[model samples]
Target chain A: MESIQNLLIGFNDIFSVYNMIIIFLGSMFGTIVGALPGLGPSAGIALLIPLTFGMPVGSALSLLVGAYMGTMYGGRITAILINTPGDAPAIMTAQDGYPLMLQGKGGLALGISAFSSFIGGIFGLIVLVFGAPIVSKVAINFGPPEYFMLMVLGLSTITLLAGKSMSKAVMMALVGFALGMVGSDYVSGFVRFDFTPELIEGVDFVAIIIGLYGISEVFLNIENLVHLKMGKPSFKVKEFIPSISDIKKITMPTLRGSLIGTLIGILPGAGGTIATFLSYATEKKIAKNPEKFGNGAIEGLAAPEAANNASVPGALIPLITLGIPGSGGTAIMLGALIMYGLRPGPLLMVESGRLVWLMIAGLIIANVFLLFSNILLIPVFINIIRMIQKYLSPIVTVLCILGAYSLNYGMFNIWIVLIFGVLGYFMKKFDYPSGPLILSVVLAPLTENYFRQSIMLSRGSFSIFLTRPVSLGIILLLITIFAFSFIKKGRNSKNQDYSEE
Target chain B: MKLMERIFIIGMMIFSGLVIYEGIKLPIKSEYTIGPGFLPIVIGIGIFISSISCIVQSVYKYKKLDTDTKFISKEGATRLGIFIAVLTGALLLNEIFGLLISMVVFMIVILRYVEKYSWFVSIRVAIISNIIFYLIFEIWLRVPLPGINL
Candidate 1:
């Protein structure tokens, strides 16, 4: 009953004219942005965050959350039309979606994808709404030790899943942690590595994000410019809805994908791309006609699309409940939440129930808007792809500069962006994953504060971490994960050697 | 790529050593708990160990495999250099010439030279983008871009 009342209040809060307009605009903008190749949801959100700086927290979150959800659905349009996925998760969609397009069922493919995405999104939201509060209820009793262990688990998971080479990912994460430590200590007020006055407050999160995701992405895309032929999309209003038999076929796959996506989404560092791939593979394995899986099968398009969209809400569960981001997109959102002076964690629901509920409510609303907007604006979005393709690099470069500079109105921030831009480019060039680096940067300070506080509580006794059951459990989990990764890596390398001969 | 990986591992080891050296100069322990240097020292050590392991792995892989990949081409290297130069030039010029002027010049150069667009198309894109940015950042968001004093 209380949950219903809270949701009602949340709806009331988001129904305001200003908030509604922002949500609509954010959804439209996200769809268009997501349709562009190389600028995925993370980059889209980072680049657009500056625009929301002036709005109220509820309004700002509504806009950003709407965009985040919108991008999940929007990415499929380009996959179906151009054979080039707008984002990483959409790569699977392109495999079957493009084949469907060649068979002159592009409109139907897009319609099914949109519908599956909506189902997945709503499924994920339901899980988030129910699961987050429960998690927070348990997490509320956690102390510094538990928090520290949780962060360690989070960092380890990201490192293990981020790249092929565990050592490189670990190295990148350590670099990020060190970079994050280069500011005045919060408790002691001792400046650790203040090379400049700007370093006193710490490197601006927005500047680094813009540099790493935005500017570096621009550098890469410009270097490998592939001219995609933007063909006209074939669509009839009558053909938009799937047939009854087709719906029946996809219903089971959509449910399975949504479930799989939500579960994977809850895991730290395993994001939408992994969920989509897993879902696609699972659907193929279960299908009676496995050979037809990637050959324009409706099940192929439905499963991954559903999985990717569902993973969006799945990723948010940890962020809102435990103050830990499960994926890169949620990490950026966590950064935005911090910028708004709201600390996300178990207490987030207690202190700002309205904001939390409203964000949840806004995502549901956004998914509904996404379903309609994607279908209604498919023609417009296709046209936008052509227009954006030519000027994508230059436009992104300007946006990156503007986004970085607007943080504090200082040149120093821009310089930070440039330096990290170069660093990020090289990291990408060498196949080093940047996700772990960004995650470490965001989580390092939290982890350090918790560690120090735990020691203080225990009077410099490191055993405090092991004394707590929750903390001990988390540490054990981290060790298990690390051991598993090491063993798996060894087996894979041995297999590689055998194959090489 | 293999050689670059080896160089990166070596560079990381040296960087971690420097961090440890600097960290040792700070207060490692406080009366109640760990000091600020604690994390840096821990992270530095972690990096040093990870980098060493990376070097070992690289050497093992190198010994097992024949080098068959070309890391870069002349054209790619030149393109990257030009991109870096343009980015640096924009950053340096943003303070002196103002953001709009520098950005306009940067966009024009990238669009015309790097992207190989015609002069007319390049200037049109530059002018239009500048206007859009000026309107959005300066007027709407109320963020003051660096501007030349009249």
Candidate 2:
């Protein structure tokens, strides 16, 4: 009953005129931004964050959350229509979605994606609401040792799950840590790498984010501009509705994907891309007609779409509860939360229950709006895509500059953007993952602070971390994951050598 | 790709060594507890080890590396170079001329020459986008962007 009352209060807060308008506009804007190739949710949120500066915390959060959800659904549009994924996670959707579009069932594909995303989003939210509190309760008992171990686990998991190579991921994450160490130390008040006055305050998270994701993406897209192609989409509005058979085929896959996504999302560093790929592979393996997948199969479209959307809320679970972001989008959101003067962690729920619930309610409301608006505004979105496609690169470049500048109203931030932009481009060129780098930058201060505090608490005894059961468990888990990756790599290389002969 | 990979590994190893060098200058232990430099030293060591491992792996997989190209083509490399030069020019322009003027010039150059769009379309995009940016950032959001007095 109390939970029901809290939810009602949350809804009431979200339904206010200003908040509702913000959510609506944010959703529309996010959808358009997501439909644009090369701009994913992280870049979208980072670019638009400066606009929310003067707004109330609740209103700002509602707008961001709305956009966050909108991007998840909006990414499907280009994936299905143009055969080009608007975001990384949407790549899976494009495999089957484009085939469906080629068959002139583009409307059905869009409709199925929207519907599956809605179902997955709602399911994920339900899990978040229930799971977050339990996670927080468990985390509340953690001291410095456990906190340090948890951060280590977070960094390790992100490294392990980053991509094909574990070494590159570790190298990238270490670079982030190195960058994070540039500022004044929190405990001792000693500046480590302050070669310039600008470095004294630390590298601005927003500057790095805009540079790495937004500016670098522009550079990459510009490099490929010669071969860029935008597909022409044709679909009748009346054909948007999926048939009974299509719905029946997708229902089980959608549910399973949502479940899988939600579970994966709860794990640190396991994000939407992983969730979507895992669910898609699972669906393919379990399907009676697995050959139909990647050839306009509804199951392929539904599973990944569902998993990607579900993973958003799943990613939020760690962010809100533990102050640890599971994905890049949530990491940006965490940056936003910090900007708003709210410390996200176990105490966040206790100190700001109303705001927390309001954000949760805002997500649910946004998903509901997305369900209807995505269908009704499909034509509008398509039209917007055609209009905006030509000017995307220049517009993004301008936004990246302005976004970085607006963070501190300084030219130095712009330089930071340029430097990191080149760095990010090279990283991408080298097949090095950028996700772990951002994650490490975000988590570095907390990890360092906790490590120092834990050691101090133990009177310089390092064994204190192993003495705590929870910390010990996390340490063991990290070691096991590392060992597993090592063994697997060895086996694969051995197999490769055998095959070579 | 092999050369680039070798350069990257060597560069990272040198960078890690520099970090360790600087980190050691800071207090490693302060008041009988871990100091600020401890984590950086640890991270630097980790990077050194990882880069070494990367070098070893690259050596073992030399045949595979031969297939990878750092750039699409020499022309593509020139284009990227031009892009960077233009961006740096824009940054300098932003400092001297301000955001609005620099952005407009930047957009026109990028749209017209880089993207090969027609002059008319490029100017139209530049003007319209600048106006929208001004209205949104300056008027609505109240961001104090560097701009003309007007």
Candidate 3:
């Protein structure tokens, strides 16, 4: 009831035509910018902030928050249409979404993702409105040991991604971990692998992703002569709308994803990347037809998309309630709040309740606005691929090159993309799962830093992970997850044998 | 495929060995914390062990593995070569001509040769696409793409 009253108060502030138009245009522009390679939520928010400088604080916050939501929604566009994810969070989306595209259901993929993103956004906003103070308490209580366990939990999904050979996936993951460590050592500040001056900042994961998923995928498509499985442009209802059965299938997964995303997004640095990953893994594990995952399962497509969007509001809970930014986008929002003369700590909600509620209200409106806009624009988006199917290889190649180049405005990352492009080809040829490699690359340094910090805080005792209650609880959860997965795998193999007999 | 798998295993082992050597050369511990070398050392060992297991599994399955599986068609391989060449050549050309000229050249070459589009279609598409890319990245986004002066 209080949450409702606060939201109504927010709506009153942002109900005018000018603010409505601002929210609409901000989200629309953000969608385009975010869909392109080399731009993300942080870039989108940063670019829009100065433009909103002279506006009333309420209106400015609404526009920025709307764009923030738009960027998250936009990531799935490329990941579904092309195999390239705009960023790490969309990686799992591509695993299933792109496959659905290949199977000639690109329109359905876009629709399902948009709907899930909307549901997830609204769900997270509800939690943010009512649960922010409570959740903020939980988030701040997390220590290094708890964070270390969280990283472990994130890494444990590697086995789920292992295609057929566990050893090969482990090898790729280990390699990714090594590559991730190439930059400065967080503990001692020592440069371990400064083969080039670029090594000082570490291997750019975005460049590698562009190479591995984007460039390498273009290579494989050219080799296989199926650059995109773009069918004749069809404006049929089924192509753009989910059937009732499809909705029934995705409903539970979307809810599950929203729950997981809200819970995990509050953990700083463990934002949508891990949430989407864990959501995908959970759906895969409990799925009736687990094999359908990664091969265009609508559940697989919907769940991670939900988690990705939900993490936005989930990520904001800490920032609004406790002044802690959970992810890079929220970190910028933190700066924006500070610049607006707003203190972001515990006094934040008490001091600036209207502004925070306005932002939440803005996100709610943006989610609804983006759903209609993205869905209505589906034919236009998919038609671009259909109309230019012949020229896609070069176009995608150029985009990948530009994407890598835009990271640093130097030719260096472009070369990195090319090198990894060839490497990615072979990895695919030999059936190596790129997921583990990418996941390990993202988490390796963070995990190491957390482990080191935990050790230091515990006076060099390694038992801190087990001694802390939350950390110990995470270990048990990991144990349960792994145990159940192994049991299910054993049972499945036995079933296969029985069928054969 | 079998031979390539063996080579990949050897390459991983070598990579793991280098990581171990580099790790040993770096300090193992810093005051009150594990040093920078510790994680790399552990990861190196992890890779080494995993590589060994993969090698054993490969060797044990060598007899049963099919060496003659059709990996890719001949024409497919040829197209792949041309595609990669065009991509790299475009980047090299970017150093001289910048992103526009290089990519325009890339579009024409790829469309005309690889996709086997006619010269009329190829050149037209090439110019139009580069213009759109330029207006978006260089003009709108202000990316300062290579060789914008040209």
Among these predictions, the greatest TM-score belongs to 1
| Candidate 3 collision pairs | none
| Highest DockQ against the true fold, candidate | 2
TM-score of 1: 0.96
TM-score of predicted chain B versus true chain B for each candidate? 0.91, 0.88, 0.86
Q: In lDDT terms, which candidate is top?
A: 1
The full ranking of all candidates by lDDT, starting with the best, is 1, 2, 3
lDDT of 2 by residue, A128-160 (tens): 888877788888877888888877876776654
Give the runs in model 3 whose Cα sits over 4 Å from its true position: A1-134, A227-366, B57-68, B148-150
| Per-prediction TM-score | 0.96, 0.94, 0.70
How good is model 2 by TM-score? 0.94
Off by over 4 Å in 2: A226-228, A231-233, A491-501, B65-72
Summarize candidate 1's per-residue lDDT along A1-501 as a digit string, tens digits.
Answer: 666788888998899888888888888888877877777788878888888877789999999998998788878988998788989999999989999999989989998999999999999998988888889889898888898887887777675456788878888889888887888898887887777888999988888888888888877777776455787655766566889999999999999999999999998888999999999999999999999977899999999999999999998988898887877788889888988888888889888889999999999898998888777777777777787788888888888888788888888888888888877887887777777787788888888999889999999899998899999998888888878877888899899989988
lDDT of 1 by residue, B47-137 (tens): 9998988888888877878874555666666666787799789878876889988999998998888888999999999999899999989
Please provide, for model 3 over B1-150, each residue's C-alpha lDDT reduced to its tens digit, 9 standing for 90 to 100: 677877888889999998888888898888777988887799999999999999888786677665646667898899999988887888787877888788889889988988888999999999998897777577655777777444
- Assess each prediction's global lDDT (C-alpha) against the native: 0.85, 0.85, 0.80
**lDDT value, residue B60 of candidate 3:** 68
TM-score, model 2, chain B versus true chain B: 0.88
Cα lDDT of model 3 by residue, A1-501, tens digit: 877898899899889898898899789767765665545676567556545555789888988988999888888887988787766788999999999988989889998999999899889888888887565456556777887786676566666656677798889889989998998875677898788998899887767766776577667777877644544445554576788999999999999999898888876556788999999999999999999998999999999989999999998876677555555567567657866888665567677888888888899999999998888875664565355556766776777777666667888988998888877888888788776776677667767878989999988888898888989998998898779768877888799889979
Clashing pairs in 1: none
